[model samples]
Target: MPTLQRVPALVASGQLAIPVAEALVALPADVLGRVQAASIDPDLADTAAFSEAYGFPVEGGANCIVVAGRRGEDVRYAACIVLAHTRLDVNRVVKKLLDVRKASFAPKDEAVALTGMEYGGITPIGLPSSWPVYADARVQDAPEVVIGAGLRGAKLFLPGAVLAGLPHVQVVEGLATPTPDA
Candidate 1:
């Protein structure tokens, strides 16, 4: 667990997406206290590049994805969190979960605008209240995981359980499948 000094305090970072600082602070100390948010090279914002450049293990990185599902005239949005090595089960499980006829990744620009986070740094922490966060069970089982800090130049390091404990977060089994190596 990292104290406030090792990395910028979530409350102290103006670079974070809107309402993230507030949402973070609202989490229980057991969850929030363990988080360490650090600055990074914006160019290394993507998980694979960041891990390679900084020597972080692939197992330690989590990827957050935003998706929009349509059920007839109704549209719903959700956020999915999974290990970097996994592929999100968007078309199958996600569509069924959302009770929608179709489900797809949200457009990058739309996701950024809706979440108030940078394109590569969109996190589940400060998503619109209407959006639910679905975390892969493997993610919560991890001892620790690295994720974006709502800013391209920053990253968040925390116990995976902390993320699973967030409000509106549901730890779902098989939310992702292992990715086949290319």
Candidate 2:
């Protein structure tokens, strides 16, 4: 396993492996400057695999999911943050939030393309300016959590409060629920 490094050190190395690294440089110390990152094998970016391999507690990580919905000819997108052990309330909540008759997870290609992040690494930070990021209440309750660094090879660690405070972020009540089968 690769060592966890401070964001500044990663930036100083000039070998930043993720697109979000460049963006993170501009964040205030209260945010990105305090983030910790660890390099991981891209193949294990998925939550279960990454947690088992890296010894990260599953609940200590958050997953960001992209949902797309359409109303008439206007299409909208939003990123939802939930704990890995929970399920996003996509059909009901997301659809209602988007004010569309239907909403669904965007296809893999669309998510990666629009977010400018890899499929397994989409994050609320640095998402398109117009997109809104919604966090489940439970996510904001975490002391610190791991999230994608916009590259499958890296994971970002930061205070959950910092994440809840990102621009264009909304903390929604009950945005997620324990997975039905969990």
Candidate 3:
């Protein structure tokens, strides 16, 4: 993994969204201790650009995508975490998991407005308490991974196991599939 110049995320207030900073503060000491934040150019916040520019393997980056599922008049939202090199199994796994008839990536504006985070920086952390966070099993095996910091100007680094342990996060096997030629 690439070594980043980082500080405890809780203390990197300016680089984090308000809710993200607050969430880090509320984490248990052990979990919080392993979370770190590093500032980056907002333009490089996307996974491909971030990995290439920062010398981190693309596979070591986690992408959090917001999904919306609907059944009749009821709609549910979830955050799905998948490795940068994989594709989330939304049509199968997530649709079944949410117990909805149809499921798809939430509109960018809806996601941003609901999460209170920028479009490219919506991390699983600090999401609404009612939203379940589904993480691919592969994420838990990574020794460390880079994830959004709830802002486009920074990223968070932590052990994958730590991410799996966060409240509301459920590790689901085969939640994502490797992208062809990735």
Instruction: Report the C-alpha lDDT of model 1 over 1-182, residue by residue, as the tens digit.
Output: 22123464464467566667777887777677787787788889899888888888888899999999998899999999999999999989999888899999999999988888898988888888888899999998889888887889888888888887787899999999999881
Candidates' C-alpha lDDT? 0.84, 0.80, 0.93
**In model 3, what is the error at residue 79, expressed in angstroms?**
0.2
For candidate 2, give the lDDT of residue 150: 83
TM-score, every prediction: 0.92, 0.90, 0.97
Candidate maximizing lDDT: 3
Per-residue lDDT tens digits for candidate 2, residues 74-105, read: 88999999989999999888888889987899
* Model 3 agreement with the true structure over 1-182: per-residue lDDT tens digits: 33468998877978899889888888999999999999988989999999988998899999999999999999999999999999999999999999999999999999999999998999999999999999999999999999998999899999999998897799999999999988
Off by over 4 Å in 3: 1-4
Q: Choose 1 or 2, whichever is better by lDDT.
A: 1
> Deviation in angstroms for 129 in model 1?
1.3
What shift in Å separates residue 181 of candidate 3 from its native position after superposition? 1.0
Of candidate 1, the 10-residue stretch with the lowest lDDT total is 1-10
Q: Quick one: ranking by TM-score, best first?
A: 3, 1, 2
Candidate 2 lDDT = 0.80
lDDT of 2 at 146: 87
